[model samples]
Target chain A: MSTLIVIDQAPYGFWTGREALDMAFSLAAFDQPAAMLFTGAGVNWLRKGQRPDGVGQKSAEKNLSAAPLFGIEALIADEHACQQYGLTESTMLPGVELVSNIRDVLGDHKHVVFAG
Target chain B: MSASNLPERNNEGFLEYATDWSSDVASVIAAEEDVSLSDNHWEIIEFLRKFYNKHEMSPPSNRLFVKAVKDALGEEKGNSIYLMQLFPGTPAKTACKIAGLPRPTNCL
Candidate 1:
Protein backbone atom coordinates (compact mmCIF):
# COMPACT_ATOMS: atom_id res chain seq x y z
CA MET A 1 0.00 0.00 0.00
CA SER A 2 1.19 3.50 -0.76
CA THR A 3 1.44 5.96 2.12
CA LEU A 4 1.55 9.72 2.34
CA ILE A 5 2.89 11.56 5.39
CA VAL A 6 2.10 15.22 5.81
CA ILE A 7 4.34 17.31 8.04
CA ASP A 8 2.34 20.39 9.01
CA GLN A 9 4.80 22.03 11.40
CA ALA A 10 8.14 23.69 10.84
CA PRO A 11 10.80 20.98 10.95
CA TYR A 12 13.14 23.26 12.84
CA GLY A 13 13.22 24.13 16.51
CA PHE A 14 9.50 24.64 16.62
CA TRP A 15 8.51 20.98 16.16
CA THR A 16 11.28 18.78 14.83
CA GLY A 17 10.68 16.13 17.47
CA ARG A 18 11.49 12.43 17.03
CA GLU A 19 7.84 11.49 16.49
CA ALA A 20 7.77 13.37 13.18
CA LEU A 21 10.91 11.70 11.83
CA ASP A 22 10.01 8.28 13.19
CA MET A 23 6.61 8.18 11.51
CA ALA A 24 7.95 9.46 8.20
CA PHE A 25 10.63 6.79 8.04
CA SER A 26 8.73 3.87 9.54
CA LEU A 27 6.13 4.20 6.81
CA ALA A 28 8.85 4.36 4.19
CA ALA A 29 10.56 1.26 5.58
CA PHE A 30 7.38 -0.81 5.28
CA ASP A 31 8.43 -1.55 1.70
CA GLN A 32 5.30 0.24 0.67
CA PRO A 33 5.54 3.49 -1.28
CA ALA A 34 5.59 6.67 0.76
CA ALA A 35 5.95 10.48 0.35
CA MET A 36 6.03 13.52 2.69
CA LEU A 37 4.15 16.77 2.29
CA PHE A 38 5.29 19.96 4.01
CA THR A 39 2.53 22.48 4.55
CA GLY A 40 1.49 25.36 6.77
CA ALA A 41 3.89 25.77 9.71
CA GLY A 42 5.66 22.62 8.58
CA VAL A 43 7.17 24.50 5.67
CA ASN A 44 9.70 26.07 7.98
CA TRP A 45 11.33 22.66 8.40
CA LEU A 46 12.66 22.86 4.85
CA ARG A 47 14.02 26.38 4.93
CA LYS A 48 17.63 26.67 3.88
CA GLY A 49 20.53 28.30 5.78
CA GLN A 50 19.13 27.11 9.11
CA ARG A 51 22.10 27.49 11.43
CA PRO A 52 21.12 26.65 15.01
CA ASP A 53 23.83 28.68 16.65
CA GLY A 54 23.47 29.25 20.39
CA VAL A 55 20.86 26.50 20.43
CA GLY A 56 21.49 23.26 22.26
CA GLN A 57 20.87 20.78 19.42
CA LYS A 58 22.16 20.30 15.90
CA SER A 59 20.70 22.25 12.98
CA ALA A 60 17.07 21.48 12.10
CA GLU A 61 17.65 22.13 8.41
CA LYS A 62 20.49 19.62 8.20
CA ASN A 63 18.39 16.88 9.80
CA LEU A 64 15.51 17.65 7.46
CA SER A 65 17.82 17.70 4.44
CA ALA A 66 18.60 14.07 5.15
CA ALA A 67 14.98 12.99 4.64
CA PRO A 68 15.31 12.16 0.98
CA LEU A 69 18.04 9.63 1.57
CA PHE A 70 15.64 7.62 3.71
CA GLY A 71 13.31 7.30 0.72
CA ILE A 72 10.88 9.96 1.95
CA GLU A 73 11.79 12.16 -1.03
CA ALA A 74 8.23 13.03 -2.02
CA LEU A 75 8.25 16.49 -0.35
CA ILE A 76 5.22 18.38 -1.62
CA ALA A 77 4.52 21.93 -0.52
CA ASP A 78 1.47 24.09 -1.14
CA GLU A 79 2.23 27.26 -3.05
CA HIS A 80 -0.32 29.27 -1.15
CA ALA A 81 0.95 27.96 2.16
CA CYS A 82 4.51 28.95 1.25
CA GLN A 83 3.45 32.52 0.53
CA GLN A 84 1.52 32.69 3.76
CA TYR A 85 4.67 31.64 5.60
CA GLY A 86 6.80 34.20 3.68
CA LEU A 87 8.78 31.52 1.87
CA THR A 88 9.72 30.67 -1.72
CA GLU A 89 10.94 27.68 -3.70
CA SER A 90 14.53 28.75 -3.20
CA THR A 91 14.20 28.45 0.55
CA MET A 92 13.40 24.71 0.59
CA LEU A 93 15.36 21.56 -0.16
CA PRO A 94 15.91 20.86 -3.89
CA GLY A 95 13.54 17.88 -4.36
CA VAL A 96 10.53 19.56 -2.75
CA GLU A 97 7.68 19.80 -5.27
CA LEU A 98 5.25 22.67 -4.91
CA VAL A 99 1.61 21.77 -5.58
CA SER A 100 -1.58 23.77 -5.93
CA ASN A 101 -2.99 22.67 -2.58
CA ILE A 102 -3.35 19.80 -0.09
CA ARG A 103 -6.18 18.01 -1.88
CA ASP A 104 -4.27 17.78 -5.13
CA VAL A 105 -1.45 15.93 -3.42
CA LEU A 106 -3.75 13.88 -1.23
CA GLY A 107 -5.60 12.57 -4.26
CA ASP A 108 -2.56 10.46 -5.23
CA HIS A 109 -2.09 8.43 -2.05
CA LYS A 110 -3.77 5.27 -0.76
CA HIS A 111 -3.21 6.11 2.91
CA VAL A 112 -2.43 9.51 4.41
CA VAL A 113 -1.07 10.38 7.85
CA PHE A 114 -0.91 13.90 9.18
CA ALA A 115 2.11 14.68 11.35
CA GLY A 116 1.94 17.86 13.41
CA MET B 1 3.89 37.06 26.59
CA SER B 2 1.16 35.18 24.80
CA ALA B 3 -0.08 32.02 26.49
CA SER B 4 1.04 30.18 23.35
CA ASN B 5 4.56 31.13 24.27
CA LEU B 6 4.20 29.47 27.63
CA PRO B 7 5.87 26.09 27.94
CA GLU B 8 3.68 22.99 27.71
CA ARG B 9 3.02 20.84 30.77
CA ASN B 10 3.25 17.05 30.69
CA ASN B 11 1.48 14.61 32.96
CA GLU B 12 4.32 14.86 35.45
CA GLY B 13 3.66 18.62 35.72
CA PHE B 14 7.13 19.35 34.42
CA LEU B 15 7.55 21.44 31.29
CA GLU B 16 7.34 18.34 29.11
CA TYR B 17 6.70 19.97 25.79
CA ALA B 18 10.06 19.09 24.30
CA THR B 19 9.50 16.50 21.57
CA ASP B 20 11.07 13.10 22.06
CA TRP B 21 13.73 12.11 19.48
CA SER B 22 13.23 8.38 19.88
CA SER B 23 14.52 5.64 17.58
CA ASP B 24 11.41 6.21 15.54
CA VAL B 25 12.61 9.73 14.74
CA ALA B 26 15.83 8.25 13.38
CA SER B 27 14.12 6.70 10.36
CA VAL B 28 13.56 10.08 8.79
CA ILE B 29 16.89 11.48 10.00
CA ALA B 30 18.80 10.38 6.90
CA ALA B 31 16.35 11.90 4.39
CA GLU B 32 16.96 15.40 5.75
CA GLU B 33 20.72 15.13 5.10
CA ASP B 34 23.49 12.93 3.82
CA VAL B 35 24.82 12.39 7.34
CA SER B 36 23.51 9.60 9.55
CA LEU B 37 22.67 9.71 13.25
CA SER B 38 24.55 6.91 14.91
CA ASP B 39 25.16 6.10 18.59
CA ASN B 40 27.58 8.99 18.75
CA HIS B 41 24.82 11.33 17.65
CA TRP B 42 22.80 10.38 20.75
CA GLU B 43 25.79 11.31 22.89
CA ILE B 44 25.82 14.76 21.39
CA ILE B 45 22.08 15.07 21.78
CA GLU B 46 22.34 14.25 25.48
CA PHE B 47 25.24 16.63 25.90
CA LEU B 48 23.33 19.40 24.18
CA ARG B 49 20.29 18.76 26.38
CA LYS B 50 22.33 19.15 29.55
CA PHE B 51 23.82 22.41 28.34
CA TYR B 52 20.37 23.77 27.52
CA ASN B 53 18.95 22.71 30.92
CA LYS B 54 21.84 24.45 32.67
CA HIS B 55 21.89 27.66 30.57
CA GLU B 56 18.17 27.78 29.60
CA MET B 57 19.20 28.42 25.96
CA SER B 58 21.04 26.88 23.07
CA PRO B 59 24.83 26.89 22.89
CA PRO B 60 26.64 29.34 20.62
CA SER B 61 28.80 28.38 17.64
CA ASN B 62 31.45 25.67 17.54
CA ARG B 63 33.75 27.42 20.02
CA LEU B 64 31.23 27.34 22.83
CA PHE B 65 29.53 24.26 21.41
CA VAL B 66 32.67 22.17 21.85
CA LYS B 67 33.37 23.58 25.26
CA ALA B 68 29.84 22.87 26.44
CA VAL B 69 30.00 19.35 25.05
CA LYS B 70 33.32 18.77 26.80
CA ASP B 71 32.05 20.20 30.03
CA ALA B 72 28.93 18.04 29.80
CA LEU B 73 30.59 14.95 28.35
CA GLY B 74 34.37 14.45 28.53
CA GLU B 75 37.59 15.46 26.72
CA GLU B 76 37.49 12.21 24.70
CA LYS B 77 34.13 13.23 23.21
CA GLY B 78 34.89 16.96 23.20
CA ASN B 79 36.85 17.09 19.94
CA SER B 80 35.66 20.41 18.51
CA ILE B 81 36.40 19.86 14.85
CA TYR B 82 35.25 16.28 15.03
CA LEU B 83 31.94 17.26 16.67
CA MET B 84 31.40 19.99 14.08
CA GLN B 85 32.07 17.60 11.21
CA LEU B 86 29.81 14.93 12.66
CA PHE B 87 26.93 17.33 13.29
CA PRO B 88 26.78 19.60 10.29
CA GLY B 89 24.04 21.72 11.86
CA THR B 90 24.87 24.06 14.73
CA PRO B 91 24.36 22.46 18.14
CA ALA B 92 21.58 24.86 19.07
CA LYS B 93 19.44 23.96 16.08
CA THR B 94 19.66 20.22 16.60
CA ALA B 95 19.35 20.36 20.36
CA CYS B 96 16.34 22.66 20.40
CA LYS B 97 14.46 20.56 17.87
CA ILE B 98 14.98 17.42 19.88
CA ALA B 99 14.13 19.15 23.13
CA GLY B 100 10.73 20.15 21.73
CA LEU B 101 11.19 23.74 22.88
CA PRO B 102 10.14 26.65 20.76
CA ARG B 103 12.59 27.45 18.00
CA PRO B 104 14.98 30.22 18.94
CA THR B 105 14.07 33.13 16.71
CA ASN B 106 17.33 34.87 17.62
CA CYS B 107 19.56 32.45 15.67
CA LEU B 108 20.54 33.67 12.24
Candidate 2:
Protein backbone atom coordinates (compact mmCIF):
# COMPACT_ATOMS: atom_id res chain seq x y z
CA MET A 1 0.00 0.00 0.00
CA SER A 2 1.20 3.50 -0.76
CA THR A 3 1.86 5.78 2.22
CA LEU A 4 0.32 9.24 2.12
CA ILE A 5 2.20 11.82 4.15
CA VAL A 6 0.03 14.79 5.04
CA ILE A 7 1.91 17.96 5.92
CA ASP A 8 -0.43 20.39 7.67
CA GLN A 9 1.96 22.98 8.99
CA ALA A 10 4.30 25.53 7.47
CA PRO A 11 7.94 24.48 7.25
CA TYR A 12 10.90 26.02 9.20
CA GLY A 13 8.97 26.89 12.34
CA PHE A 14 9.19 23.39 13.83
CA TRP A 15 11.37 20.33 13.34
CA THR A 16 8.42 17.95 13.40
CA GLY A 17 7.23 18.92 9.92
CA ARG A 18 10.74 18.84 8.50
CA GLU A 19 11.40 15.53 10.23
CA ALA A 20 8.34 14.15 8.55
CA LEU A 21 9.71 15.16 5.17
CA ASP A 22 12.96 13.44 6.10
CA MET A 23 11.00 10.31 6.91
CA ALA A 24 9.37 10.51 3.50
CA PHE A 25 12.77 10.75 1.85
CA SER A 26 14.04 7.82 3.88
CA LEU A 27 11.03 5.75 2.95
CA ALA A 28 11.51 6.67 -0.69
CA ALA A 29 15.18 5.70 -0.44
CA PHE A 30 14.04 2.20 0.51
CA ASP A 31 11.86 2.06 -2.62
CA GLN A 32 8.61 2.44 -0.77
CA PRO A 33 5.65 4.04 -2.51
CA ALA A 34 5.32 7.38 -0.80
CA ALA A 35 3.38 10.50 -1.71
CA MET A 36 2.91 13.85 0.03
CA LEU A 37 -0.16 16.03 0.58
CA PHE A 38 0.20 19.66 1.56
CA THR A 39 -2.84 21.10 3.29
CA GLY A 40 -3.54 24.14 5.50
CA ALA A 41 -0.39 26.07 6.32
CA GLY A 42 1.59 23.32 4.69
CA VAL A 43 0.66 24.93 1.38
CA ASN A 44 3.21 27.60 2.16
CA TRP A 45 5.89 25.03 1.57
CA LEU A 46 4.89 24.79 -2.08
CA ARG A 47 5.20 28.51 -2.68
CA LYS A 48 7.98 29.52 -5.01
CA GLY A 49 11.01 31.61 -4.06
CA GLN A 50 10.86 31.11 -0.31
CA ARG A 51 13.88 32.78 1.27
CA PRO A 52 13.59 31.63 4.94
CA ASP A 53 16.57 33.93 5.57
CA GLY A 54 15.01 35.83 8.44
CA VAL A 55 14.91 32.66 10.53
CA GLY A 56 18.31 31.30 9.47
CA GLN A 57 16.70 28.05 8.34
CA LYS A 58 17.35 26.16 5.17
CA SER A 59 14.68 26.70 2.58
CA ALA A 60 12.19 23.85 2.47
CA GLU A 61 11.49 24.98 -1.08
CA LYS A 62 14.90 23.69 -2.07
CA ASN A 63 14.20 20.33 -0.53
CA LEU A 64 10.80 20.13 -2.19
CA SER A 65 12.42 21.01 -5.47
CA ALA A 66 14.69 18.02 -5.05
CA ALA A 67 11.95 15.67 -3.90
CA PRO A 68 11.63 14.10 -7.32
CA LEU A 69 15.25 13.01 -7.22
CA PHE A 70 14.46 11.00 -4.10
CA GLY A 71 11.58 9.20 -5.89
CA ILE A 72 8.92 11.37 -4.23
CA GLU A 73 7.09 12.66 -7.31
CA ALA A 74 3.53 12.45 -6.18
CA LEU A 75 3.20 15.90 -4.63
CA ILE A 76 -0.27 17.32 -4.06
CA ALA A 77 -1.36 20.57 -2.46
CA ASP A 78 -4.88 21.25 -1.24
CA GLU A 79 -6.69 23.72 -3.51
CA HIS A 80 -8.61 25.18 -0.58
CA ALA A 81 -5.37 25.72 1.24
CA CYS A 82 -3.93 27.43 -1.82
CA GLN A 83 -6.95 29.70 -1.98
CA GLN A 84 -6.77 30.41 1.72
CA TYR A 85 -3.15 31.37 1.32
CA GLY A 86 -3.97 33.27 -1.89
CA LEU A 87 -1.63 31.13 -3.98
CA THR A 88 -2.23 30.01 -7.54
CA GLU A 89 -0.78 27.01 -9.34
CA SER A 90 1.56 29.37 -11.15
CA THR A 91 2.88 30.63 -7.83
CA MET A 92 3.84 27.21 -6.48
CA LEU A 93 6.92 25.28 -7.46
CA PRO A 94 6.71 22.95 -10.40
CA GLY A 95 5.64 19.28 -10.07
CA VAL A 96 2.83 19.91 -7.58
CA GLU A 97 -0.74 18.89 -8.36
CA LEU A 98 -3.52 20.98 -6.88
CA VAL A 99 -6.57 19.08 -5.68
CA SER A 100 -9.95 20.41 -4.74
CA ASN A 101 -11.16 17.35 -2.84
CA ILE A 102 -8.45 16.27 -0.46
CA ARG A 103 -10.57 13.45 0.92
CA ASP A 104 -10.93 11.85 -2.48
CA VAL A 105 -7.22 11.93 -2.90
CA LEU A 106 -6.61 10.46 0.57
CA GLY A 107 -8.89 7.55 -0.31
CA ASP A 108 -6.34 6.39 -2.90
CA HIS A 109 -3.73 5.61 -0.24
CA LYS A 110 -3.88 2.87 2.38
CA HIS A 111 -1.78 4.59 5.03
CA VAL A 112 -1.67 8.20 6.14
CA VAL A 113 0.93 10.04 8.22
CA PHE A 114 0.10 13.47 9.53
CA ALA A 115 3.29 15.47 9.68
CA GLY A 116 2.04 18.57 11.41
CA MET B 1 47.98 18.49 22.47
CA SER B 2 50.12 16.14 20.37
CA ALA B 3 48.63 13.29 18.38
CA SER B 4 49.72 10.81 21.07
CA ASN B 5 47.96 12.88 23.74
CA LEU B 6 44.79 13.04 21.73
CA PRO B 7 41.93 10.85 22.89
CA GLU B 8 41.12 7.73 20.93
CA ARG B 9 38.81 8.45 18.01
CA ASN B 10 37.03 6.47 15.37
CA ASN B 11 38.32 6.64 11.81
CA GLU B 12 36.03 9.57 11.20
CA GLY B 13 37.47 11.37 14.27
CA PHE B 14 34.53 10.86 16.57
CA LEU B 15 35.75 10.23 20.12
CA GLU B 16 35.74 6.55 21.03
CA TYR B 17 34.43 7.39 24.44
CA ALA B 18 32.02 10.26 24.60
CA THR B 19 33.20 10.86 28.16
CA ASP B 20 36.65 11.66 26.74
CA TRP B 21 35.15 14.70 25.05
CA SER B 22 36.20 18.07 26.37
CA SER B 23 36.40 21.59 25.10
CA ASP B 24 40.08 20.88 24.39
CA VAL B 25 39.27 17.94 22.13
CA ALA B 26 36.64 20.00 20.37
CA SER B 27 39.08 22.84 19.88
CA VAL B 28 41.69 20.55 18.38
CA ILE B 29 39.22 19.03 15.95
CA ALA B 30 37.65 22.35 15.03
CA ALA B 31 41.10 23.74 14.32
CA GLU B 32 41.69 20.85 11.91
CA GLU B 33 38.55 21.95 10.07
CA ASP B 34 39.97 25.51 10.09
CA VAL B 35 37.31 26.75 12.46
CA SER B 36 38.35 28.63 15.56
CA LEU B 37 35.71 28.26 18.22
CA SER B 38 34.01 31.48 19.10
CA ASP B 39 31.36 31.70 21.84
CA ASN B 40 28.79 31.09 19.12
CA HIS B 41 30.58 27.94 17.96
CA TRP B 42 30.75 26.66 21.53
CA GLU B 43 27.03 27.18 21.94
CA ILE B 44 26.31 24.95 18.95
CA ILE B 45 28.85 22.32 19.99
CA GLU B 46 27.37 22.09 23.48
CA PHE B 47 23.89 21.88 22.05
CA LEU B 48 24.94 19.10 19.65
CA ARG B 49 26.46 17.10 22.52
CA LYS B 50 23.28 17.42 24.52
CA PHE B 51 21.20 16.50 21.52
CA TYR B 52 23.28 13.37 21.02
CA ASN B 53 23.02 12.51 24.71
CA LYS B 54 19.26 12.75 24.60
CA HIS B 55 18.53 11.43 21.13
CA GLU B 56 21.45 8.97 20.92
CA MET B 57 21.97 10.26 17.36
CA SER B 58 23.15 13.31 15.53
CA PRO B 59 20.55 15.28 13.66
CA PRO B 60 19.70 13.48 10.45
CA SER B 61 20.65 16.45 8.27
CA ASN B 62 21.54 20.15 8.16
CA ARG B 63 17.90 21.16 7.86
CA LEU B 64 17.01 19.44 11.08
CA PHE B 65 20.07 20.88 12.78
CA VAL B 66 19.02 24.39 11.81
CA LYS B 67 15.48 23.72 13.02
CA ALA B 68 16.75 22.35 16.34
CA VAL B 69 19.05 25.30 16.85
CA LYS B 70 16.29 27.75 15.96
CA ASP B 71 14.00 26.08 18.45
CA ALA B 72 16.60 25.95 21.21
CA LEU B 73 18.44 29.23 20.64
CA GLY B 74 16.66 31.54 18.20
CA GLU B 75 16.39 32.35 14.49
CA GLU B 76 19.45 34.59 14.30
CA LYS B 77 21.67 31.72 15.42
CA GLY B 78 19.71 28.81 13.91
CA ASN B 79 19.89 29.51 10.18
CA SER B 80 22.00 27.39 7.80
CA ILE B 81 24.16 30.25 6.47
CA TYR B 82 25.20 31.21 9.98
CA LEU B 83 26.13 27.59 10.67
CA MET B 84 27.92 27.27 7.30
CA GLN B 85 29.90 30.42 8.18
CA LEU B 86 31.07 28.96 11.50
CA PHE B 87 31.65 25.37 10.37
CA PRO B 88 32.99 26.31 6.90
CA GLY B 89 31.47 23.12 5.58
CA THR B 90 28.43 21.00 6.35
CA PRO B 91 27.35 22.18 9.79
CA ALA B 92 25.87 18.85 10.89
CA LYS B 93 28.99 16.92 9.99
CA THR B 94 31.54 19.42 11.32
CA ALA B 95 29.61 20.26 14.47
CA CYS B 96 29.00 16.60 15.28
CA LYS B 97 32.67 15.84 14.74
CA ILE B 98 33.80 18.59 17.10
CA ALA B 99 31.10 17.68 19.59
CA GLY B 100 32.57 14.15 19.55
CA LEU B 101 29.34 12.56 18.41
CA PRO B 102 28.87 9.94 15.74
CA ARG B 103 28.54 11.10 12.16
CA PRO B 104 24.86 11.43 11.39
CA THR B 105 23.80 8.30 9.55
CA ASN B 106 21.28 9.97 7.28
CA CYS B 107 23.18 13.15 6.36
CA LEU B 108 24.36 13.35 2.75
User: Which candidate number has the best lDDT?
Assistant: 2
Residues B32-80, model 1: lDDT tens digits: 4345677787677666555554434344234445555666578877776
Candidate 2 segments whose C-alpha is farther than 4 A from its true place: B1-108
Q: Compared with the real two-chain complex, what DockQ does model 2 have?
A: 0.04
Residue-level error in angstroms, candidate 1, position A90: 2.0
Query: How would the docking of model 2 be graded?
Result: incorrect
Report how far residue A33 has shifted in candidate 1, in Å.
Answer: 1.9
The 10-residue segment of model 1 chain A with minimum total lDDT is: A11-20
* TM-score of every candidate relative to the true structure: 0.49, 0.55
**lDDT by residue for model 2 (A1-116), tens:** 78999999988888877888878877765567899999999999898888776987667887666466456759999999999999887889888988999998899999899985
Listed per prediction, chain B TM-scores read 0.57, 0.91
Give the per-residue lDDT of model 1 (tens digit) for A18-59: 466556655544434678787887777778777665676556
Across B1-108, the per-residue lDDT of candidate 2 in tens digits comes to: 755677989887778776688888888998788888999899999988776655445665666677678878899998989999988777888998899887765666
